[model samples]
Target chain A: MEREVNAYKCRKCGTLHYPFRMVCKNCRANDYFEFDIEPLPKRGKLLTFTFIHNLPAQFEVARLGLGIVELENGIRVTGQVDIEDPTLGMDVVGNVEVVRHDTYDDRYGFVFRAA
Target chain B: MRDVYIIGIGITTFTRLEYPLSEIAAYASMGALKDAGVTDVDYVLVANMGSARINNQSALASAVVDTLSLTPAGAVRIENGPASGASAIKEGFMAVASGMHDTVLVVGAERMREVNNLEATDFVATLTHPMAEYIYGVTLPGHAAMFTRLYMEKYGVTERHLAMVGVKNQNNAMLNKDAHLHQKITMDGILDSPEAFTNNPWVAEPIRFFDCCPVSDGGAALILASKEVAEASGKPMIRITGIGQATDTLAVHERPEPTDLMAVRIAAQRAYEMAGITAADIDVAELHDAFTILEIAESEEVGFFEKGTGHLALERGETAIDGKMPINPSGGLKGKGHPVGATGVAQVHEIVVQLRGDAGERQVKDARTGLACNFGGFGNNVVVSTYARED
Candidate 1:
């Protein structure tokens, strides 16, 4: 499962919490009791973006490429933009890739790319 | 509601010092005790936004208590991003007003310099969306800059307008002996200096290094007690008549207007309600100017002026210490230094000083009632406090 996107489902309230959550914010269900959910919508609109001249040494290769996007479903996420010309309300899509040095071996992380 | 008063406040120099965080906190605690003319205290509230990131430790409450040698009493640590200081004061005020303790010491300290700049930025970024913002790499200055651009585009504000905020606060800092940066910088100096790497180098567009607050290592403490205890302590009593707090979405983009901080509005409304006064009743204020634009925006958000009028307020000297409402007399975060968790407490400390007619050169004449507004993480969390002299 190198460089693959993952899903998270809230055990209580059935509200899916992507990435992960200590407990469902919607429901104070302490026991995570993990389960699978549909992959997050790939397409989104760029709510805002920033150009980082400085970044962590490990993320140097991805310099000036990070931003946050609001999915059509209104789920906001941060990821790397594949191209320049980033603007507010610009449409983008998700991509799964090995970001290098994943905390979990053989795992890929979700990143954003220009649609 | 029982009457509660903030008797005295003390703060260490805000600078890039090498002193241990514990020592800095102790000095502030002792200074506050001395200022209030008290020795023993019932409760101690510590506020530190992120010692886990700075020192990789979380025993901040125990550290302050042990350093001050105040034992067997209630002690707790409060964490509310940059508003940690104000949040701790809220807790201390409630505890004493509720008759839980007669005297309480509230110390807010942060040793941000312990970590390098990048690490500190990263740690602060954690206050943003963990998986959405930080994991993808977003710094707070970056967010503020975006909002700055939007605010300018909509409100027709300019860099010159933003620069005035730095200029005024820097001038105020010059009068503050313990300020982190006290040099009086002209708008031209800020724009023309090649050495001003962060000042103009552009950490994020619209928010230069000069616009942002310093990553400082310092501490501030306040002594609070019931009105009776304050009377017995022989210190000038600055009553906490109104205290209000509110929250907004953690993510900046989720806010109704990236430029507008509604959290401040909500807190201010509640504070005014609690105090039974309007914004017009305020004699002076110490705002959370973590960034220069924040001072402008927060001033408006808290009803000091109409929306989109904050920039003009700065230009017309309405925010000057001698103006209609003196803002940031202690130099603000821009010049005084933003020691994260200590900022909110420092705001209260400055208000208490001004209210007591003890602010010396920076004092606002005929000061009676003082207000402080401290916000955390782009107004995600906010605390507004109002203080009045017993006179």
Candidate 2:
């Protein structure tokens, strides 16, 4: 089973927030509706990226590529980017993928690739 | 409110301390008490982060008070992420300024070296938003790297400008006996030479190894008193003139603009307004430079230079010890070391030393006014303070 990326829209302000927010930062509304964004375009523009060489000793990789992606819906999310030479303003696509396998379980999250 | 002054200050060497956490706080507190020539204080405030998580100890203030034999004096602990040190001083200042206490002791300490570097990194990462940032494995360096990349693209800052900051601060650290990084780093060694890539590898892209502060264990203390007690101490009167604190969105991505440190700007404006001073009035400053990029960004945010111009000022040598405005003359966290809880207090300790003409080689000449910015949680919580030498 693949995990899907999710976002919540504030009922009062019509603002979208990822990972779910309790209240609308813009409108101070307490109500929100869950929105499934699975069919939405996985394409996004890369704002910035980094090659993280030092990581907590959970996985065995020497380095990981991380970046912030601004989706077409204007919501930004941080995830692993599977590209070597990441440049500013590069178009990328997001997919639900397994990031790492810790001692206890296989951790899964969003990963981006060059579109 | 009454006037509050710092009568005494103390600090332990910024390095791997072998003693227990309580002992570290007590050592610095005893030095402060001896300096003030006072055997007892009306209250004690301990500033610490991760004492409970990293050291497996809670009620740290209670243990410290007993360790220093300062029993019967009110004791409390202040934890405000990386800004805990100055936050404690603010509490002490309020106690004295409110006339609730004539004398208050504030101590900031941390035992980060108790855990290894990976654990230490994870420990610090806890400050990030659990659901948004930390759940995705966003470390502080990773955040700084992304910020640096964006700042560079926006302001035309280059790798050379960042290296200059590293070179200047590490050289300054060589003069500070209490500083953590003693070795002087050069542009050729870290950036210019062919072997530089191997010598100074990237921990996070765009932010090399030298651009980051080392994890350290240390403690710092300050004695805050009212005018009467301050006068009796017979020491130079350094007034705690202004204090400003502000907060921003807990998640970095939630911010309107990732590049602008709005919290720092608001906090500094409040502090300057309270002090009745402008950026030009400050002779010296200690900025939170947990990463090299922060020093430049904070310099701009704090009004030292126009936005997108701090790196240019670095090119002009305007921020050196002998420049128009000397910043981080005590080497800052970049070189002085960051013990999380102790960094903010140590910044004030260096400023007080500069105001008293006690900083041996790194002193800014005739520094009458100083500012310290203690940034917490990647600009989520920030505290800005101003101090003036009152002769």
Candidate 3:
């Protein structure tokens, strides 16, 4: 599993976007630079969450918790959360791990855990 | 622009039908042609999504037109995610309005049940952002769950409110023979009973099984004609008074405020302006309710109520069939079923039926002006249309 996630920052407007964008939405600039984010903080707050019982065939888990976590950088990203009971605004921290494995390869993604 | 009117409309029952995709479209088209008492049209527009991927079929318009024996007429397909139906209707409206075609036939169909539920879910997930949302396995219900969570925190909308919408629409569907869900669901059976948890499990957090629309297979068709052609048919004049469409960012996180549906607002505003009317003037409306929360959010976004107060209107029974201003009287996507591409045209079909006083038990009394909102891609692409009966 990758230890850190990658993001792109638009050089002109200082907008940080994950999964990258060619043009800056704010300033319409085409300049950007890629950088690996430091390990997510040990603690963050959950914006909202859902317990997904019905999942795609690729994910073997019977049920999974998915939520949007607001990192200290104020960037919100959708990730799987490892929590038995999750409440809005609950503190969570990023845990880089293998989320699933398909016929091809093991897939790694972020799963937030209660601090 | 010349005035356009709906000469006829037809829809198939929204359920699993073991038929070819082209056959579904052809069936609905034939019904509409018979309703209009016309054997030929100047053009044909087919609205479909996932035909190539799920059904392994392309050139859907040509197949449908040929099957309907409407060959030699200009035919094309429209794919706009889930909003394809309304988009094609808008195109038909333009064709008639611009004098390009005196009569146009618009048909929306989808055979999503060709695949299993899992494959169907994954196929629909393609509408999400490839890298940001889809990569992390985000589905429509997941997005709606988060959106519902935020809406609840901001507006005090509880689970009861969501259940209310589900029960209301599902019950309303009892009166609609063509609706997909025939089993009547009540708050007690699906919500308050001891077996409720098992009866309605969570598909995504905050969004339960009942909160979602069934993946349906169906088709709906409408006949659009210029005023002269429509008048000659001796049918009730249901004029296409307004059309408005707007788009938003491909990714949901990019929006300045994730909670605000700007596309819906802009599209509805433009439609109202073009129609020379306001929200208060609508006697009935068919807002896309793929998720129960959407009916509430769209009601406010379309100016039916103030922001954060749509649930209040629901609490007051104002959105019921007998309410002051009825919404989703045809049971909406919740009960009527959502065949993706067919949903938008089905919405129009329901509104036209209501406006014509042919909606039977579900008819909105004294209905004259109606509105239809066809939402696509989680509020990214929205189409709002207004219709009025000319006495």
Q: Give the Å error, residue B159, model 3.
A: 1.5
Winning candidate number (TM-score) = 2
Query: Arrange candidates by TM-score, highest first: which order?
Result: 2, 3, 1
Candidate 1 chain A lowest-lDDT run of ten: A100-109
Clashing pairs in 1: A3-A108
Which ranking of candidates, highest DockQ first? 2, 3, 1
Q: Interface-residue RMSD per candidate? A: 3.1, 1.5, 1.7
Which pairs, if any, clash in model 3? Answer: A50-B205, A51-B205
* Cα-based lDDT for every prediction: 0.81, 0.90, 0.89
Model 1 regions lying over 4 Å from their true place: A1-38, A61-63, A98-115, B192-199
lDDT of 2 by residue, B1-391 (tens): 9999999999999999999999999998888888888999999999999999999999999999999998999999999999899899889999999999999999999999999998999889899877556756778999999999999999999999998998889899999999999989999999999998788999999999999999999999999999999998999999998999999987787677889899899999999999898888999999999999999999999999999999999999999999998899989999999999999999999999999999989989999999999999989999999999998
List, residue by residue over A1-115, the lDDT tens digit for candidate 1: 3343444677557766555566776777777464556567778887666566555544655345556677776665656666667767777887877443434543244566677
**Which regions of candidate 2 deviate over 4 angstroms?**
A30-41, A100-107
Name the fnat for model 3. Answer: 0.54
Per-residue lDDT, model 3, residue B193, is 92
* Model 3 / residue B50 / CA error / Å: 1.0
lDDT per residue (tens digit) for residues A2-115 in model 2: 566777766665767775667666688654443323333478999988988888777467888888888898888888888979899999998877775657876666689999
lDDT of 1 by residue, B1-391 (tens): 5899887689999998797887788889999999998888998999998887678778788888987888876789899899899999999989987887889999999999988887788788879866455655567887777678777878988888888898899889888887899788887777756755545666666567678888899999999888888898788878998999999877665554566788899999999999999999999999998878889898898899999998988888999999998899889999999999889988888888888888889899999998999888878899999989986
- Candidate 3 docking DockQ: 0.54
